[model samples]
Target: MLFQNVIKHCRHYTAPVSAICKPSDVFTNLSNEFPYYLPKIIKTSLTKKKYEDNIEIKERIKNLSEYHTLAREPIQGKLTFLAFDALAESKDLTEEKLHQVQVLAWAVELVQSYFIIGDDMEDNSETRCGKPTWHLLPDVGLLAINDASMLRSFIYEMLKNNFDQNTSTKVENYVNEAFLTINIGQYMDIMMSKSKDFNKFTVEQYNFLNDHKSSFYTVKLPILLALELCNKVSQDSYENVNKICTDLGILLQMQNDVMDYIDRDSAPVKTSSDIQKKKCSWPAVTALQHFNEEQRREFMNCYGRWESEKVERVRELYKEINLPHLYRLEEQRINKTVLEKIKKLPDNATPSADFFYKIFDFIHQYTEDISPSILKSNVSMSAI
Candidate 1:
């Protein structure tokens, strides 16, 4: 599992580096401070034999760790551990900053778990990270919402417990701001799904949708949270980090869309969740805007419908439109632009270049292996 691997890697580091050795340890330590720790409640309740015998509740909690391990297990815990270790290595990280980063990492993990739980329910998904999704197992369903909410509450608890001091107001403020941004992005994504005409979507709209819905949570929030934890509280700091992180987030999401269409080995059952949901993904909206009228009509006919043959027809249109080539070009361009932007950051303001570099490296490593076929064609957003 990624979390386990992360724990192992962090432990391998000597002395101070070992502080972040275990995420569960981090969560447990931080949660001890919260006035109300829901995981403690869930944990206590689940340990009761009767509760475990309930079968349904057991499955949901059981799946929680599984969903988390998906992101952690593959990279051998390198992502979170590396992020945390960067702070450990920093000569400037105050005790408060160090604690904030730990709590922040915990908060982000909680948020991610919340999303995965709710997303599984929303998509009616059956499995995640090789096991049944929370909603799919007996006795789970709507309770998954509560489980997700528990994850959200954990964020507040961590904040209140660890950052209640006056000096930490900036960290508090940034956390709230990032939360608002994510909510706004999620709202836009839901609204786009209900939109009437797929053809009406512009490339700009597609970019906006992807930037908000996918980018903020994955890229923007994590890095911004890091900045906040580092006590880099100036508006300039937030703005610079936000812009860079948002761009990286958008690129990561675009790559995700591309991967869904192309990667056959992906754990998600179907690749066309975005198409089925009528998401205004970059490729879909781009195709709609750029393809000739005849091709456009063909695309509309096949767009979100579930038939296998029609999905194949959509793939054909991508090839005809040279979408794979376009996607490759756009990806390379965006990556280069992001790298240049990162380089331009004032040396003092940015963390070690290796920190940012590792992040981009992880994104590239994950998405680069995906075949162009999955990327150039439309796929389901729900799958993620």
Candidate 2:
């Protein structure tokens, strides 16, 4: 009964595309048959594994998408603004590309939700985007795989309805490639963390993870999508975009690693997912790099264990190594490189190099990783 009355039901599908076509609308018009789109697959995986007729079960399955939607950030959605902004950078955004942006941005949201749900399940994560993981909900265990699949299905359905054949095909190709690259990155993360052998760790490994794991989908895909919408995609432009995203993506993962440790005590939404999961991140790799043979062997012994004492030892080791100081130095270097790459963006990339600098500042402030007591110490990060 999952799709039962999904469209015909007035309450769930009542809002018109016009009603929720604005970026401010969190739902993104899916409930209202966006672009006259509808799912064609009847036996969705939600039912492929198991099907339930209970109204509440259906409601919980629905929330798989809604929860992530409720917690959605504008990280990717904001890229869609390139289209609206291209129409008038100096002028305020009117309806000049509102509908199209809304549709495409929602597609991004759906795809993101798919990945988040799957990641949570894969990590055995307790929460996502500050809410309980969907897979952890009552009667939802294992069924979340199907729920994530369902979210993914919407992305293609909606895309088919909204974009031209050429743009849609290009976007589909990028998305397919991102899925493969991102999965490989995720697999590397899982395998590396599980291995936990000091010999397996390397700076080169960290850079590889950053390339596929952090940046491609998050930065490059959205930027490419935005370029396509703005009629600016070119081989040369993509090369520049790829380089910029790789640099920024590395910095982004570094921030995630450092910020988790630095803001662990104070930041409202801080998480130690990386530490708990034993993921190969900037801090973990860096800490191991600084460790002597004995120290590295000692860490490997208990690094990935979930027990309280083991986790505490890992935390103390991070402090003992002064990871915060190392992170600040790396942050400055990475940010400088990112700015230089942006400056080389052919001078016609949307929003210009100056705009990315502004974004770089906004990213820092938004992340609020500056709250670390150590960060406020002798080093001045004003240049970054």
Candidate 3:
């Protein structure tokens, strides 16, 4: 049995001393350390197709599958966090159980990859994972849409093949439901951009959007799925896990919004696309709260033009209002609140809570992606 065989590997595994090890140290080898079961799963699904006899169709499937496999690299550790946390909490903590969780983690990553490919196409994004997006490749174009669906379909294949048939059905339902929620959130976001009304955007709506679109998939889904697989989730624990993970997700999404305005890379680039898209993001919505008549008018003037000059103008306006400082302060406040909430989770949910805190620390403490200005001082949330 795959589960029993998993013990051979776990026997060699040495638990790292906590605090001495970085989260990166835990996840740095995810792509290499974990078996690449995703490609095999994808191949199994693709091979079942009757049209494989067609040479051209076969080549396209091969190319799409290869891209899918290639994109799985540089794992972001979302799955690692859930799998290891579940393993930590398990009474058995057997190699077989850990292996099952790891496989499910791959499923989570594959689901994320599916959406990312489709999202890039929707946003007309040029690059992903430091390379051209799948849709942007020569002759791929709209065919990437089909490829994205194929990836989504492969998630079910992985679940069905790896788990008990009955349990796989539940997992499949959860995956589909999560994607539906994400699609609704995406729809709201795209509609908000199309409407282009900054005045109508509110903190409530921003939170609602992130809660559905970013939080559910990025944090809640992975933890919940892992817990389900472990047979460890309870009603109260489920509610609490969702609450904590949702908050963390919203905080992370806001960080993304703020980072958009800042110089994230060594090289300077164009201003954030949110500015160009006129998307109602956390930072932008917060800025609106503080904007005076003149500043509001100035913002309205440059909010959503495709021109680089207009984007630059919005960047300057953000500085004029000290939006960056305000954003930093808001982030500090949110981070504190999220940490406090995580700490308050019930004893039953400690594994889930610890998983969240590790992620929070990794993002807030370990990563230089966030500027020092944001983390250095305690800022009042009511400052605005």
- What's the lDDT for all of these models? 0.56, 0.59, 0.61
Model 2, runs deviating above 4 Å = 1-62, 82-96, 263-273, 345-352, 355-362, 367-384
Those runs of model 3 whose alpha carbons end farther than 4 Å from true positions after fitting are: 1-31, 34-37, 43-77, 80-83, 86-96, 264-272, 349-356, 362-368, 371-384
TM-score for candidate 3: 0.78
Each candidate's TM vs. the true structure? 0.72, 0.74, 0.78
For model 2, which pairs clash?
none
Better model by TM-score: candidate 2 vs candidate 3: 3
Alpha carbon deviation, residue 211, candidate 2 (Å): 1.6
- Which runs in model 1 stand beyond 4 Å of their true positions? 1-66, 69-84, 87-102, 162-173, 263-266, 269-271, 351-358, 372-384
> Worst lDDT window (10 residues) for model 3?
375-384
Q: Residue by residue across 198-288, what tens digits does model 3's lDDT show? A: 7679999989987887777766677677667767667775687676667666766776676667653422111236888888887679878
- 1 against 2, candidate with superior TM-score: 2
Name the lDDT of candidate 2: 0.59
Which whole-number lDDT from 0 to 100 does residue 86 have in model 2? 35
Q: lDDT per residue, candidate 1, 50-123, as tens digits?
A: 55467665555545533553333222123433454554534644556545555565555555566667666666
lDDT of 2 by residue, 1-384 (tens): 121122123222244322323332323332233323212221132343344355554554455545665453445555444333433333333343345556665565556667777777777767544557778888678988877786676566556555678877877787777777878887888888788475667888888976887577666776677667666668876786676667666666676667666655442122356777777878788999897777677678767787878877877888888887787677666655665566555556654554454344434443334455533231111110
Model 1 error, position 366 (Å): 3.0
